[model samples]
Target: MKLTKEIQDSIPFQYANDVRSGKITTGKYIKLAVDRFFQWIDSAEKDGYHIDHNSGMHVIEFFEFFLKHTKGPLANEPVILSPYQQFTFYNIFAWKDENGNRRINHVYEKVARKNGKTAGLAGLGLYCQSFDDEEGAEIYAAATKEMQAKVCWEQAHDFVFKGIGLRKIGFKNTQREIRFEHRERNGNVRKGNFRFLGGDSKTQDGLNPSLAIIDEYHAHKDDGVKEVLESAMGARQNPITYVITTAGFNTTSVCKAAEDVYKDILDGHKIDNHTFIMIHDLDEGDDWEDPANWVKANPNLNVSVSMKYLKREYTKAINQPSKIPNFKTKHLNMWVDAAETRIEDHIWMKSDKKIKLANFIKNGCAGALDMSSTTDLSSLGLVSNPDENGIIDILPLLFCPSDTIDKRSKEDKVPYRFWKDLKLKDYIDFEGTDFSEDNFWEKLPVLIATHGNQIDYATIEDYLQKLEAIFLPKWWEYDRWSATQLVQNMTEKEIEMHPFSQTISHFSEPTKQFEKHAYAAEFRHGGHPILRWMMSGVQAYEDPNENIRYVKNRSTKRIDGIIMTIMALAGTITPEEDNNESKYNHEEFTL
Candidate 1:
């Protein structure tokens, strides 16, 4: 029951202990993987499952014993699993069901670029084909293209050399297949086969796979190949779908979709006890420049992945903006587009300007409305103190249809699932009727009040009614397309509505001011995750006149919240535009 010094050195055990003891730096999903793993281990006895330590150790030790390191400084030496690698191996092979089937039926790992994934997966493929107890095991290395699929297959093929895992192995080099004569304890012999399957193959039938290793899942446009190959597993009593790759650029890729679902499982939004997930990457708050953060994603940092080479590349990336995206993607394991990005994450994370609605309600503030077309998002952006100090605080309320959360989340890759309220986090599902004139006035304020059951609806309405009693604005602004019933209602209240055209001439100056205020400590957003994501996704172009305009490109994120904030800031900067004298009257208001 106790871990000896030798056992304590195991990558899987060490990582499990480090995560349980809170000793290692990790991200949101990494924490989920570690916690869920231990939870499974603790509940195994009660679930009629058994922990086969020998079976798990057999995998890790097998890889270390016979797998040769192919193309590194340690080339030709046996492949020794790092702590993170050992953790993965331990999870996939250690637990067995009541009928002695492997508990982990599938594993999807979103790891950094160079942690020896190809070599490791090749070793596992060889083990499944030649060493596992199963008779006639079929293993495959699959990908979208034939050339891409052959990389892992070639690695597995190279392992057929003498002294490798499956010593005296038979390799049909022309056909790209490896066969082993596995002997049973009863002196009966069976043929275990491993081969490469290209995505160009017409049909994926006739494969009774025990293990399918999918490499570079991010490169695949969809999960077509994975689905077809996984479909071949029904006949096998114990089968596994293994996916391994780095972060991808295209948000619509199946890897991206699966990545989100895995995060959901990690965060306890859903449960999938059979699949093992681990995302090796730096946590959100960790400084990417720090060498220590490199180890967060690259578990093999100093070993197979050189610290000196990474430091050199990091220095270059810091100095050259063009190289930064690729460096972050490959080394730091962060998902970033190589295209132009406007709002910097480091700047947004440092902002500290979130104010309570009650405090802002006491003071008067101007509001801007952006009700995107009927099928999209509707948002209200509030900016306080337009005249004297110029936007002392900000209050944003975002609304989306209850039905389109998943569609929007997938399309933009933003965490809309977390922005359902006026809070700076995720979203709340809106269940009311369409955002009509009557509905907007009624539903918008309630979303803010009901978050975490902090305040009731009537109380928040009562507080806002007091604000309406003394509501005045230096100016109220809105995008032209948002001339809704709500816009008419606010105008009828005599708070002048300025229909600002979204043009370079009109918004160029305020947009620049907004950027300046953020970096110069003049403006602050409450460090909302969705806001940060929107800021990073903004695609802007600068004209020859030194003015800027936002242009939508092929990026995989939405900028709705940031757009609303900009509209709010537009009114805040034009303080002298108040034309109505009776705007400051204690206006009667009701929901």
Candidate 2:
């Protein structure tokens, strides 16, 4: 519904002169109260809240009655509630009942960062503690981290102690909860108290809560924490739960779940039993750099926020989009792509279907292995014999240390226990090995032993000879056109691979360079979904200058399949000829 200024002005302001004194009459007050309530209810409806109310004022009255006799400092504290704040609190806390018994409701809001979320939450927490149904009602301001949870608690304490005329409510600074309890039901007499607790599953479990406010919910790493907190509300008839957060980085986390739930409401996929409100600036195509977007994203513009700070931040975002994913996600309220280049999910899934371990043995394959000691997985790829057109079929094998395995043992070195656990000891022959070992002999033997069709001593030695004397030299000086043709042909087949360390480490930079020159270059790997897929899994190195030294940042995921595809391409080796005769002799070459 379109909200006009006249309609907005009709709502009651917390202070007499803030809007107009005439708007404070019981009828106008009730209407304004009802309108504020419905505004939130409507927002909740849009977010999938289910309610059977012809008027939202009824719900508001139910909460008002529930809180009417409650005695506390907040009951008499002068409250200058905005029309918007009034509506938000009523909708968030009030719900109708068939038995006329007051029941609490759930409220979830996806708002942009720095929109007075903390203050608003704190105000509601104090309100719930002071005036909600239960005497000495417990209120909580929770967040993903200790600092964030504490901030909400601190804000609530400040509002109680420092806000005009609120000091009469016994606000005591203590090691644990701030006490606001009153003994008599008379005006300004202590009756009930509210306490603040840090946001943690363990800390939240012991509290019997009347209301719970989760701040910065998008950052919550544990979904289980939410589950645990919700259980505490089961005993309260009208316990309220509020989840507040800004836009999240990607769809895999709690932020994404909130976004999805919001979408489900709009799409009519879910009915709203709870209130969900989302206030963001840009829709889809709105310029992310525009300063106007900031104003739209933050509704509290001149009230709770400084325009000068926003302007400074906006300028920084426009200039360097790549440097700040969190800033862009939170301040600009935009979804940042996970990486510069993401491999389409469809391509990766399809490639996975074509990978058959048996095919490598059946086709007389050759192999390539890339090993890493720091920050990467050891990867092996095997290629099948060339077809009439001279293209190789590739497959991949990836190995990494287990999570339980300690990186540092008593010696303060990365433990080799993971290598043994993954059975990598058999695949990797590190005996008498060092970084300076000759490239051809050092890696070739291990590759052959692990993946070769024939593993006898003589056969293995002979195969190494063929690869070193013939394959290595020809591969180094192979004609660019022939090599390109071979790679192009292999691209048609669905390749089997998982992410390996070496490919993930080097792929991003090369892919970036390739993308920059994609249209101008003749044989760009940009179109290769498999290559791009592997590149997307790469994590940035801690050292800015060292792009090649990357560790597997996400262990549950892999890029070994794409590494296998690359190695398959590398297997398109041909015999070298000297004076029109095939030469199968090794020659020493300087690195």
Candidate 3:
């Protein structure tokens, strides 16, 4: 392929080529992203996009020539971008559409700690405020707390005082903000401001931003800052929201949700043409102990992040197992929970087989309902009797309020609505059965959104009656605390409801069995994404008596599906002394 001068000179392009040619090592997702970049470049013209080499180069020049380092040994020195840093800036500024407008309006960047993420992005923020030529431009560095919000802003704030060129512009450096005074062509004075916006700030009204840099987004408990910044950018011609962060412990955070979206774009699952994503994380099964693999996450490995420093951290993590999760999260750029997870991702993924649920209809199943929170996700998990191969198939039906799906989607960063639209056929097999011939069980929705803000108990009762008539589940288990009313209503409908105690002793055996089935690949979950995500968040908590119960790493994380699955598994565990292994009756059931 013929390469333009811009492509040939681009550090990111070279990095991509090297990664593709095996000259450099990286995670599969990073490799996939770079590959996508090259593919897009090759077909960009036909796709109504163009690479404005000069525009990207101009931004790079501003960084190297104007910005100066404010701290460490490089204090007062001109900012020199590492190859990966250059790649980041080039991609963001280079991509353009048919109208010569910036193609990328948003960018999500994930890098390991000590990679100069704040400093580099701070320079970009300053550039957007001054050089972007937007009238009365507003630039914000936002975070959940005031201290965190000031981190990036301080870096940019210091650059103005240190950089001679920026200093000459007479920037008003206040205690909380920096401003550039200017007048329009009509002789009207306008002041462009750059400020740090904390979540507790008084008000964000009447604000119009040209660039909003969200730093350390993973630490955010909610989407308040992000939501405000995004909604305020509607009036700008080419506004950009730059989210930059390292890996964090909270799997249920808004940052992790944003990561999922960027990941989908990289994986070719979904498309958002205006968003640019570059993530650096350890690949699946990558040995974090290996120094050779460290560069995959820390792209500026030997530059901004020293090998000696990382080695010291790794050694500490090795000697003290408690520090391992922190090392992985901060140094290796992996989103690990502070507590160790019960099931490894590889082990859990092994049960993702396409088993036909319709074929097991005559085989009686057991169910468990988890309605722990009326305002959050509720699940009804069904488990079939072990087949001749000792494999148990699972079907989990999830529910949430219709009115809160979108709200929760934005707040929790999970796609509740998308999951609700998914059907059984999307994940499991439905062939060679009467149920497959029509839009019945085969097309049964996996997640249903009930009307209103609170879960409608009547809707759950109706569904239970339908399931009992069709599948004839032997019994249904319910949590004693939250399901008393539901159980009472179901009992009136002739459905056997058992109160399941939510205790360590009660859950231990079934939890152990669930793990056993998972490890042996005897549990078929059909690779449901929601279940997989919940499984990822699960951590085993052990009592002093050696009894164990399922718990989520974070309180905000929803593991109702996993809990219900464990409860349902209890009913399928037949005693060894009972020679009659067939738990289900041969009699057919009718709806």
Best by TM-score: 3
lDDT, candidate 1, 303-373, per-residue tens: 77788989888886665443465577667777764346655677666555544343344456666666665
The estimated TM-scores of all candidates read 0.56, 0.49, 0.58
Identify the leading candidate in terms of lDDT. Answer: 3
Q: How many backbone clashes does candidate 3 have?
A: 0
lDDT of 2 by residue, 180-286 (tens): 66555555453444555444434554766777777766666666556656787777777777777766544467667666675665445775544444444355666
lDDT of 2: 0.45
Worst 10-residue lDDT window for candidate 1 reads 582-591
Model 3 poorest ten-residue lDDT run: 582-591
lDDT of model 1 at position 16:
80
lDDT of 3 by residue, 231-329 (tens): 999989899999888887768778898899889989999988788888998888888899988998998888888899999999976654435666787
Tell me how candidate 3 scores on lDDT. 0.79
Q: What local lDDT does model 2 show for residue 465?
A: 38
Per-prediction tally of clashes: 9, 23, 0
Clashing pairs in 1: 11-83, 418-426, 418-427, 419-426, 419-427, 420-426, 420-427, 420-428, 469-586
User: How much is the lDDT of residue 279 in candidate 1?
Assistant: 90
Ranking by TM-score: 3, 1, 2
